[model samples]
Target chain A: MAVKYYFYPLWLRFWHWLNAVLCILLILTGLSMQYSNPDFPFMRFDLAVSIHNITGILLTASYLIFLVGNMITGNGRYYHLNLRTISTELMKQFKYYTLGLFRGEKPPFPINEKRKFNPLQKISYAVVMYVFIPLLIITGWALLFPEITIHDVFGVSGLHLTDLLHLIIGFFVSVFLIVHIYFSTIGATPLSHFKAMFNGWHKTHD
Target chain B: MMIKGMRIQALIWMFFFMIANAGLFAQQTDSIPENVKENQKCLKCHGNKYYSYYNDWVEGDVRERMNPFYVIDSAEYYNSNHKTFTCIDCHSYEYEEFPHPGYLRMEPSYSCMDCHGFGDEWAKFNFEEIQSEYEKSIHSQKHNETFSCWMCHNPHEYKISARTEENIKEVIAYDNAICLNCHADIDEFMFIAERENPNVLETHDWLPNQALHFKSVRCIECHAEQSDTLLVAHNILPKEKAVKKCVECHSDNSLLMASLYRYQAKEERNKAGFFNSALLGEYYVVGANRNYYLNLISIVLFGLVVLGIGVHIVLRIINK
Candidate 1:
């Protein structure tokens, strides 16, 4: 039998869509500015800079909303890992991805109404939200207010270090985005997970 | 067919009109003044030859005498920015007699300030402040060391505006050339160098890459007052007062930023004011410049990540 469960909440869905749009815009504009070939202009240099800065600010706000929503609605517990079983569960997920999934084995931990993500999803999402995204925000702010920051580090100025870190982490985010989109299609139906994200109900096999 | 015929007739009429106008414009520009043509004769002797003589001997000692020479190669003079101006515009005195008056040598009155010192255009630039500052500088304080503006700059051959990075660097290199001409010479620089420092390299040891610093940055940027404007400060400080702190030039709002940048757009300047990285387009500083290597690394990383995702997708499909 197939069952319908409320997997994505209204606030989470709104935050997810906003974050998704901003991330995609930021990545496109950021790449356009960095490469900077007039022959292959993605947009005018000034336009790219303006759009990138505005979208970055919006993304920061959306991130805060996500954090607050997670806490206030008690959705934050879904992300909490039992440290003792974390390695064992991580290995099980890893094995499922590498070998077991190829032989038609089921996921080690499945998503439910209470537990929103599989073990793999929980670890990756937590890291992206808590670690990578925060680093990007901190570095972006540092780049914006270079006059007040540490002026130089390791022969390069503080501005350069901030740019370098931002670029490095931005690469990781780009990779995460690609992987996230691909993984979103992994459900009973290709559109089932996407539908769940939009309407808050996911179809699960029992 | 009728519209095409009309277009051809219009094109022919326009071509003939352009030809007639071009001829008229050429005639207008070709009319040089009668006085300017007459002054070309003055270059016959003064422009083609070199003159040298020795003077100021101590007890008639030949080795200790000072040698002075004047040579203005016509080829070089014609190439100068001041080539269009007649000689009398600058040497503003009456000396038309066959034998020039001896009083001309007695007076040292020719000055750029006579024309460029005061006026709406000149006063707006504040060149008078620069002149006053120059007078108060360490170079002016020395009793025996008298230097003129011509010593460092050729009034004839100067670039007022360097629009490109290469041009800006070339202008800086030319200005530094005057200092290097004397400083690189053991006989001229030995006295100054010894009084300043025993070791030239050691004096500038605070700079991480002294060679690169000297190559790109003007000497006055460190040895003069940090100017808010693009012009170099004329009040040259003593060696003791020179800026040595690394942060002054390394920071986001660097002291050298104004003079170091050239031909920047208004937007670029404004962005730089807010401590933005948009101004990094023209030049590179150690920590302040962007690296293309990071972009290459990002591309490779993206490729690897995509490949990993592709494999994951293929396996999922096979399982399904």
Candidate 2:
């Protein structure tokens, strides 16, 4: 039997889709500015700077909204970890994805009304959301207002350090986006998760 | 008792001598022929190629008889615009005396503006604009010791760049050398600065490709005030106030457009294709020098990512 659950709420769904749009725009504009050239431009130099700045500001706002919504909503609870089961459950989920799924073995953790994310999803989401995103945002803000950055740290210039950090983190986040989108197809149907984000319902086999 | 009394008398004599000859040391005079003759007499000792600090022993009862400040390089003096006019043309007339009146040393020194600012005779040199910019410089901010143009520009050897080579690289080196003479030397910097001198290399380590930048541009490109009136801005800002943002130079509206490249021939700048296209003819600035190959590489890499995603989707469909 298959079941449909009202897993993603309206506000969470809205934030997720909005974030998707903002992230894509930011990625394009950021890459364009970073790779801009005089002889052959990825985009017009002026246009890249303007678009990157504007999109980055918008993404900052979206990030804040996401933070505030998580604070006031039940969706945040799914991100909370169970220390006892974390390691064991994470291993189980990893194996299920890597080999068990193709071998037609049952999933170690399945989505239900009581649980929104598997252990692997919870840990990865927590790291990307809580750690990488915050760092990126901080470095991004530091770049925007260079005066706020430290003048020097261990003989390294703070601005250069900040710029390098932003570039590396941006690259990782971009890669995560690619893999995240691909894995979105791993549900019961390839388009099932995409539909759930739009309609706030997740259909699962019971 | 007689020897003690003689020593006391000698001490009193020395005090009175110093008090009486206080105005004697001022260096210059106004008469043209007399100025040359007088200067030649003084230069016999002062203009010695090796005249560094003048403390040679003299056969006299005098203590500290030689004035270290009296030494000036004859080569540099002759190289200056004031060469034919003699030392006394700028210094006090009392300097003509073999043992100058010490009180004359207390007289104010003559800056270029003493004569140059007086009329339109040297207006073409833009001394007025330079003075105006200098007035607003961080160096001009009130301190224990007054800062002056002579600190950075040794008037004795400062050949006006505009009158010399327009090659610009040499001009940049000459101008930057003046700043480094003080900044790179802690002992020299201490004369003007109250705080401990910053380590130049450490302070500038944040500057990307520092050696390239140092060689290519004047220090004033980042440190000096940006002004519209002067060809080269003279108002040096404090370090904290200097341009720190990379975008200040890296962007399309590069500050170098008004500064470093300002001397570039119009035809050179007008040969532009895109932003900083003309700039590539001379040198490569990291952000400014956009290359076709790099842009293509980026496009190819991004296309590969999207293509990989499409391939995975196709594989998934086949499995389904």
Candidate 3:
């Protein structure tokens, strides 16, 4: 038997889709800038730059919305990292993905009202949202006002360093997106997790 | 990895080759070329101050004024930096008789580019682009008949001026002197323009503390091409196209960088074609240059993120 649970809330689903679209747009435009080859066109360089800057601003606003919504709705608990159980839970999740997943064993910890994410999802989401996203936004703003943000930190040039950091973080975000997509396919059915994200109900084995 | 290593090695070899060639070329400029040595006969007359006297009368409305001809001071000529060159070196016209037929008005004036082209040994110093730029200049287009290199540079006394760290003020004075020769005096400026226009000071009245700007910056810094390069392109822009934006020179990636902070590596002049924060430290250009420590932290954090992800992937696969 299977039971349907309201795992994803309305605002969370909206934020998820909005964040995904913005990330995809940013990555495409960012890649175009990084390579800077006219022959390999994602779009015209100037157009891409304008769109990228505008999307980055919108993404920052959306991120703030996510943060505020999480606080007000009490859904932030799902993302809170419990350091004691994290290691053990992470190992169990890792084993399930590699071996037990193929053996058709049940999920070690199922999603409910209190626990919205599996252990691995919780940690990855926290890092991506709390750490990487903020870094990207800060670096993006620095790049926008290069005259103000640039300085000599040690002997190295500050603007050069900012460019380098932006590139590195962009790479990580790109990799994370790939991993996230792949992990989304690991539910009961390949489309089940995606459907749950689109609506609010997720089916769990009993 | 192998390809990348080979590319690095190639760059290193190329760098060394450039350094070696630059040193060898620097030593060769000490001696004058053979062409200047062959024109002694023409030099004997023209090099003498007494030989420069002219009998032409000035047609003045008030009783025809007898303006005595000014002579080319041979003593000054000999002491000049270009003393190795003869009169015919620049004249380049036939003069077989005692009273040369084309002496007063030489048929063909030698263009400065005649010896400055790529084939010349001196062209290795990278002045070829300057010729190309000068041809496209508004000055060249508008005053082709009136404009000649001698107007600014005395061909007989031209010497290379060094622009070092300590002598920047000297360099600015020296460079601006060429522009000021005609520009500073109203009579000379009007004579060169060959028409009546508002004087330079009056034209630049829109700028605040315009005299200070004139003192600190070269005219060409704003009047020439707005390139990232430090090299002053010879394309003298028209007043309409001249840089009017105050922020263009004052902000980061300033136009002054190219005019003032020229490429340190003369050989790699093209390499440092764009703005670099490393090149901008002595003079702070706000917003263009950034802090290096924050950059390092960002890089390290990014690396850790990648490592963590890699480890997790490895662990997951290992459990299988």
Interface Cα RMSD, each model:
11.0, 8.4, 9.7
What's the TM for chain B in candidate 2? 0.67
Candidate 2: count of backbone clashes, pairs at least 3 residues apart or interchain: 18
DockQ of model 1 vs. true complex: 0.08
Candidate 2 lDDT over residue span B1-320, tens digit each:
99999999999999988876664533323333565576777787676533223434654343333355556776677666666776767777778764678898688887878888867788766888899888888888754166888887776566667345556668778888989998888878887785668888899986645766787678998999877756778889988899876555665666776776655533365442335554543344435544455356546876887887787567556655
lDDT by residue (B91-180, candidate 1, tens digit) is 634645434587776656455577678889766456787677777777666622546565455665643443434444575686667666
Q: Which residue ranges in model 3 land beyond 4 Å of their true spot?
A: B1-129, B143-320
C-alpha RMSD over true interface residues, model 3: 9.7
Fnat of candidates, each listed: 0.18, 0.04, 0.00
Ranking by TM-score, best first?
3, 2, 1
What is the C-alpha lDDT profile of model 1 across A29-142, one tens digit per residue? 877666554444557655666788889889899999999998899988989978788889889988987897688777777666777777888888989999999999888776
- In model 1, pairs of residues that clash are A156-B287, A157-B287
Instruction: Give the local distance difference test score of model 1.
Output: 0.67
TM-score of 3: 0.54
In angstroms, the error of model 2 at B317 is: 4.4
The candidate that wins on lDDT is 2
Better of 1 and 3 by TM-score: 3
